[model samples]
Target: MSDGARVIVGVSGSLHSLTALHRAAEEARARQAVLVPVLAWTPVGGERNYRARPCPPLLRAWQELAEGRLEQALGQAFGGLPIGLPSQPMVLRGEAAAVLTGLADRPDDLLVVSSGEQGGLRTGLRRALRRSVARQCLKRARCGVLVVPPSTLHEDLRALHRGIDLRELAAA
Candidate 1:
């Protein structure tokens, strides 16, 4: 809302997240706001397991991996950081929803996330067991929330992976 507002987006290196990142960049450019792309990570065996036996070296390695992932996602999304748009990429230790909501606390800030819908029985089952980041952000974020759906290419790839022939579908 204000000229100094920020556009915060969650990036997890997934196709849907990349789509959201691009959309967030577009929004930031349009609104003349700073783009804050955040990547959240948890320990390999969850926080409780890590806390039970904390390994500082492993933790540092994981943190470096998270930073690399954020950089890779940004590179894949825009070849590099978007030109003419101020950007701040962050790697935090937490769940995606909590990290994103916490960063986008300002009322004028805009939070963007992916719909997180993938076409696979295993993925569907996994998602069913957990609330998606987008859903959580929609419920918890104080700022404006924008959920970007997966791109058409992503759906087509999923269909292909499921053995649906695109040529046959196009012919039909």
Candidate 2:
């Protein structure tokens, strides 16, 4: 917690991401900043229709569905979190790392994301993209970036989890 105005947490539908979200929430509360949990929706490659366009209504409905699921996930993860913070989840249409890096461009914003948990099967492109995006964010973010790994954030969070006044935490 510092004199930050906002903290953006990248929340993928993974256990590690939720852990990161919880930590970000606590940091936001302590810093007197609003929490914006972002769930990115990037469409993987599909067969291109050479002579057709999808309906706008259909796309809107799909967006709505994704938002609804995000809401449900938030409720399930943070319902009893005991986190007293002003926070909301936003579902955006874009690649995950890029979206997060873009948001980190704000002057008083901090980027909090989980790392080292995407070890299932990283395609060559996926690996390259992730590394590129992460490096860019580290270099460009105006405020500090918190890269929380699944195994480390738990203890780090315990140190930062004082649900007290933000001003006090920042001043200290």
lDDT of 2 at 13: 58
Model 1: residues with Cα > 4 Å off, grouped in runs: 1-3
- Each model's lDDT comes to 0.92, 0.69
Name the lDDT value of residue 35 in candidate 2. 90
> Mind giving the per-residue lDDT tens digits that candidate 1 earns over 1-172?
3467899999999999999999999999888899999999999989999999999999999999999999999899888888888999999999889999998999889999999876678878988888888899999999999999999898678879889999987798
Reference-based TM-score, model 2? 0.67
Q: Estimate each model's TM-score.
A: 0.94, 0.67
For model 2, the stretches where C-alpha displacement exceeds 4 angstroms are 1-4, 44-52, 80-83, 118-136, 152-172
Worst 10 residues of 2 by lDDT: 42-51
